[model samples]
Target: MSAVPAGSPVRTGAVVPVLASAGITVALMQTLVIPVIPELPRLLNASAGATAWAITATLLAAAVATPIMGRLGDMYGKRRMLLISIGLLVAGSIVAALSSSLVPLIVGRALQGFAAGVIPLGISIMRDELPSDRLGTATAQMSASLGVGGALGLPAAALLAENISWHALFWVSAGLGVIILGLVLRFVPESSVRSGGRFDVLGGVGLSFGLISLLLAISQGADWGWTSAPTLGLFAVAVVTILAWGWWERRTSEPLVDLRTTARPQVLLTNLASMVFGFAMFAMSLVVPQLLQMPKATGFGLGQSMLASGLVMGPSGLVMLLTAPLSAKISAARGPKATLMLGAIVVAAGYGVGSILMGSVWEIVLVSLLIGAGIGLAYGAMPALIMSAVPVSETAAANSFNTLMRSIGTSVSSAVAGVILANLTINLGTHTLPSQTGFRTVLIIGAAAALVALAIAACIPTRSPTPTPPATPASAEAPATA
Candidate 1:
């Protein structure tokens, strides 16, 4: 592999936008079915628990495939893997659009999940192609696309669900996928850098099993009875499998994850903080919409429709988009560590304010904007932090692993929030709803998570960690100068 010639043109102007659009498209899939989740059981003629698999399948598949696809992106070609990912998204959307029942929908969703690598891969591509000065903001925007798409997609999805068949949602997803795929092919360039190596088939299998078992336990624990044999058994299997996987990863010459690189204090602490930030970030998503849509009769409920709630939440994503560049500027001047800390502090403050000011729609909107800004800032800094500490060859895999940590955190937050809300419910006439106390408690916990992330970010070294030697590429000699 060789670098592009010094005089060769790089169409960076086109690359960043295309990659970012690719990222936003993949993210839309995550929220595409959210508006239809409650109606799923009736629509699909399946039990509620069975229909829930529509969501779980995507989670499990994303968790399992993100890292593996990322590794392939590094080894083969980032652009190549990215195209394959979008292709899967298109295929999944079409399959889902055609499905009238549970099984195919779940399968389609799992395939959509396989595209979760797109964002990290896009970040990696930006690193490989963008000018150094352009890299931070480009990656920041790409990172924020997750929230941007989720926030923006909700109202559109709600509208579609209200006026159009639910299947229309998948059709739209497929249509967008096709457009993004064409744009990527036309504008994005395959990187010359490659970490050529045989795929770690065994490690991938082990990690997949471990993640699936762990997430299944966490996601289903409440319904399964937290202490039930199935939940405990899955937890046990997860712990053992992850431990064995770690052992094997440490020993394998060509590993699925380079543990040595991952264990560096900078990388380790960033991942820990990412998980905590993820918990804090998701806490808002869980609390706000419910607060907005709750019946006004409960004394606290706002009684808004799903579309109204989504519209109210829409500005938060806009704030995130607007804040991404500022985050990059902060990272440039003060360091990514400072940006991360600032973001955490803002998040904590947002939740703290949310706890006190839950009385009106305006107050909730303010809270959403504050937290969205915080998440944008934090998310922008993460790739810089990871890239600074990792070898160029390992960029996608390392970033993918960080993304996985965040996903894990959100999963745990969802489970914990569900338990808190389920156990602390108030009866409104004939309906049971999460009590104001439960929502308050979740907000408090969200603030606590932000504070924890802040503390963890504080522990990160003031200086970048000394990077380990770049791994030997299986197909080519090491670069003469790095």
Candidate 2:
């Protein structure tokens, strides 16, 4: 395919803010329900496990939708797919807001998961449309927006939930979705790049089932005993289906994911690093709020309210937001590998600090700041690595794969952390704390995961050399004549 003319106008600058808004809307939807998780049981007459679906269902939906949407974007158009995703978000939020039962709420949240593709689509658009000089900063800002939205949305959602009602949070999200849709429709220019390929319907279906089976097994394993028949059956299905899906992708002409490109050392290693980073990053999201809000009556707990707890974690997102540009600079000066290693080391240090200091809200806040900075640096570097490694054509699919890895990492970490915390209970006479010992144990594990990612990042070779063009006799003769 021919490239756009060098002098032709591209509205990349105008597109950035609209994509950023979309990023924030998606991030907010993911975490806005967190502050309400504790109250859901009473409000909806549901059990803790059932209420937890509000969060997991969104995750599961995103896990399935991201890759599918990425492939669809490749097959159709990124801007078109993006608008469709935003429309889904608006509709989902409205449905969730109006729901009177957990079932409808889960369905709505699932639909919102389709919007997770917005970030990657935005990144791909930047690569295709932005000028070379501005590309680095634009990518960094877009990547940082993920954490920014999450951090900014947490406190906002907390306050809204505290002042109004839980449903109000969804209503606010619906409003933001509409505004983002308007911005995108008006400002984001349509891509001239179009995929002439056909969609892999069968591959998409198989992959979806494979992912759902695996995620459901992992997420529900603790609730159902690990050795139970249902768990074992799901695990078996996941293994067989994923293997089959892999085989199918390899044979098909236009695979849902380009496995050959994805298997490149740089791409593979970057994705592995993403998994470890995702695991460590999400552990904080799970542990910090719970640690802060646990009653002080239980020796090791601070016992802050839900709103206050969300606020404590909220600043970490802000720190991440502030550091994204700095991270881009670091990557520019050194390389994405160096930046990733530095970020991982910082994350390891943050978790190590958390393991030692868990008594006060301020202490947790300080640790969060460190972790947030680490995430900013690491998250910003990932797309740079992926984009650099893959051809421009594969950008969206490659990114979605990386995103999927991160989500899987988070899901695994959530399950593992849940088990550890569940097993370790601190007795406070009348009540119990979340085994301070257990929390410490999990933090140590998180720190260790970061160190492992740091090692992987360190091992990746410096930039691969660009191929040299062969000299032609005509060119050589011209040079001699000159």
Which candidate should be chosen as best, given TM-score against the real structure? 1
Tens-place lDDT per residue, model 1, 276-344, is 999999998899989999999999999899888888888988898889999889988888899999999
Q: Candidate 2 lDDT, tens digit per residue, 86-188?
A: 9999889998999888888888898888788888888777766676656666677777777778777777888998899989998989999888888777777
Clash counts per candidate, in order, are 0, 0
| Model 1 misplaced regions, further than 4 Å | 1-8, 464-482
For model 2, the superposed segments whose C-alpha errors exceed 4 Å read: 1-8, 464-482
Global lDDT of model 2: 0.81
